[model samples]
Target chain A: MTTITQGHAAQDHAHDSHGPARGLSRWLFTTNHKDIGTLYLLFALVMLFVGGGMALVIRAELFQPGLQFVNPEFFNQMTTMHALIMVFGMIMPAFVGFANWMIPMMIGAPDMALPRLNNWSFWILPFAGTILLSTLFMDGGGPAAGWTLYPPLVLQSGNSLAFAIFAVHLLGMSSILGAINIIVTVMNMRAPGMTLLKMPMFVWTWLITAYLLILVMPVLAGGVTMLLTDRFFGTSFFQAAGGGDPVLFQHIFWFFGHPEVYIIILPSFGIISQIIPTFSRKPLFGYSSMVYATAGIAFLSCIVWAHHMFTVGMPLAGQMFFMMSTMLIAIPTAVKVFNWTATMWRGSLSFETPMLFAIAFLFLFSIGGFSGVMMAIAPVDFQYHDTYFIVAHFHYVLVPGALFAAIGGAYFWLPKWTGHMYDETLGKIHFWLSAVGVNLTFFPQHFLGLAGMPRRIPDYATQFADWNAVSSVGAFLFGFSQLMFVYIVVKCIRGGKQATAQVWDNPEGLEWTVPSPAPYHTFDEAPLIK
Target chain B: MTTRQDIDPELQRRIRRNALMVGGFALLIFVLYIVAVALKVAG
Candidate 1:
């Protein structure tokens, strides 16, 4: 691997061709993958704070005996929009950002396969999100019918519904385009020697995720379009009166939504796969199996959408089949979990911030997954469905699971992205605070849900007060803990200790071969795969 | 990078197969929806 110092000639080369366009046009016209990646990441970070603030409001409203903070209708809107924003606006975009920035580097390509289309895909997001968020302040209310947008109830929702349906179309459109870009880049633009199996885990995960995005995003777009027409254009695509079954709407939505959950979490698995190996000073265990399991899970995702709607009065045999199919996902997911542990077994393990989050992810995510399996049981889901237990289960899965892995990934790759090391003391503090805050926030909701507290209500029955108080306190702590994340990320970007080309001691991959704070355009020259 | 012919033929074939399968599945879903709607009308 050749490392070129930024001599005057390279600096001259850099400034000469890539002329300054001041602020707006640089982001608009430039097709640089890193620039687009930065756009995605920055968008996600801003939206994270937005979503996080919504959670606090939800918690604050639920903190006491009566509706203290907001009305029940407004509270419902917050939960609905919060879920939508975090899933599509924040988590998905962050992972896509990682893909844009790192896939080419890992695969030895200089830029995304369709760079102009990439810019177009990203630029659609802000406008789409604006349209959706705008619904909150308009007449009746936002799409308060929950993120699922189950028909009948969703049908009677406020005037904001059409805007949300269109907004979802725009979001899904962006995702599909972004996924296609990743797919083409992976398939067509790898360096000379990097084979499919030999590509980095992050690239592999994004490859599968891109496939998931393409297949299901259009299904989602079609479903919402039907909803739009059903509501306004006098079509009966989802209305029973028009010969459209409500259950069929579910079938279409879950066909999209179930895979959408995987869309949220798959890249986290890839991040953990990469980080576990690097921090443990071991090659990823069952690397081949990891790839197979990821693909296996993706394949299974399409078949298991019906599991989410187990209560819709399908045939008993159908229920049994969906229940069993959902359970089958456990096999591949367990493979990933066990492999991460095996990779960490007795190697030169150090508790860096990244590794700390990875370890927390294993325990917390597994707890969430175990509960998830319980929820998969048709009878058990009858008890737990639409309860705070369900909320606890997914927040656990998403917060520590996907979101923690994201922070870990950000910490792990920070040195590579910036030419400096973040403060270890601060990083570790942020991780610990986040872990504590995560547990504080999510654990009590389990009791509330199991105690028969239903979700989305601004006011709870008196029986639910104690656990609700505990949960509220946890929410406040969790919200504040994220401020530390914002600080550390900013501090690192400004300046810190100069990082080595290989930031971690045992890290392996093409990314380490580049200089720290990877050059503006990387993977330009293909490295011969050893 | 050299053209696809220069690399392993097996890998290229596998790539082509994966692409075809994914594309075929998408097309199948598209066709299934059309059939479902048609059946709803005719039945």
Candidate 2:
């Protein structure tokens, strides 16, 4: 390894171009994986605040439950655009950012296999986001058909539908390109002797995630194209009045949508898989099993899209098949949960900020999962569908599940990325406040949903007043606590205690083999595998 | 300090071409949608 480093340094100095490019062009045209990753992370952070502000408006309006804030149309736009922005602009890109930064280093590659493509993939996001956001100021306001963008309803969604459709196309293109880059990088760029089984869990999870993105994003593109034609080209693919079935649209959407949920979370699963072993001081208990389980979950994801549409009046046999397939996802998911627990069993454990979030993710995500299983039963879904209960279930999964893991992963890697250890006290405070805020925000919605408060509505009867107020208070707290997160990140980036080459002593991956803050060029002369 | 030649040019060229193709496909989707909308307005 030392010889490899020395050789690379000699070669690097020969050309006098080992460092990142200077100024704006560095971000605009350069293909350095680390720089591109930084751009992605910063972009996601901005979008987080942008999307979070819309959520604040939403919770504020729902607080008193009589349309006290924005009008219902604007409220619907907020809901629709908020989901679109968070799912596409914030969560997906953030994970891709993590991939860009971490995957090459983990696999001992100097850069992404396709650096120019990497650059192109990232640059598309901001443009897509801009188009999506600009629709709000347009004459008819933004797409207000909910992020699902169902036909007829979406067809009536003012002029903003075209912008929304185009935005989705661009976003999908960005994701597919990014996925291709990841697939090619992992397959073709790993250092000699770093075989598939030897790769980090994060890399494995991302490989599966990229495949999921590739498989489902196109379905979305196709489904939305059909909707576009129906709206503008007089096609009746999804219009019941013109011999087309609206339910067919739901079928197409969820086929893409269900896997889309996993596409968001599987990377979080990978992050947690990486963090648990580090904090617990154990090799991941079921590495091979975890890999197989992730693959199984991905396969199951494609089959169970109809579980989301149990209320759409499918035949009894169709309902039964979807319900059972949905429930079967629990097996692989549980295998993962049990494996994490077993990895932690009787290990020398310490509650660092990242570990704390990972543990919270385990408990809360499982709660979400159990609720999902409950909803998977076609009979029970009749009661829960389109209700606040459904809202509670997904928020539990996304907020504490994927979002928490993302934060935790950021904390875990901050030292390596910035060459500075974050403020431990501040990190813990951020974690605790976020945990409390999240519970307060989403927990009561379960009761509200069971009590028949439908989702996507701005106002509800007074019967739902108390819990709504409680949830609103929680949303405010959660929203405010994230400011502390942004502050922590900025403060760390500006300056902190200089981190060591190996940030966490116990973790065994190629990333730690490089210097803290890494280098402009890493693994240029590949290290021997063993 | 590795020079430009140290990088894989063939791979880079392939990625650049493929990326443009994907970007073009996305552009095609946008064009098709705009045409459909325009046709609706015109007809």
Q: Ten-residue segment with the worst summed lDDT in candidate 2 chain A?
A: A1-10
**DockQ winner:** 1
Model 1, runs deviating above 4 Å: A1-21, B2-43
Specify the poorest-scoring 10-residue window by lDDT in model 1 chain A.
A2-11
Question: Candidate 2: global Cα-lDDT?
Answer: 0.87
Cα lDDT tens digits, model 1, A89-108, are 99999998889888877877
Alpha carbon lDDT of each predicted model: 0.84, 0.87
Clashing pairs in 1: none
* TM-scores, one per candidate: 0.92, 0.93
- lDDT tens digits by residue: candidate 2, A1-530: 11122222212333335577688887899898999998998899899999999999999999986879799999999999999999999999999999999998887777898888899999999999999999999998999989999877998877778888999999998999899889878876777677888888889999999888877787788778878888888887777787776787787789889999999999999999989988998889989899999999999999999988888788999999999999999999999999999999998898999999999999999999999999999999999999999999999999999999999999999999999999999999999999999999999999999999999999999999999999999999999999999999999999999998779855767777677878777765665575
True contacts kept of each: 0.05, 0.00
The DockQ figures for the candidates are: 0.14, 0.10
Docking class of 1: incorrect
Steric clashes per prediction: 0, 3
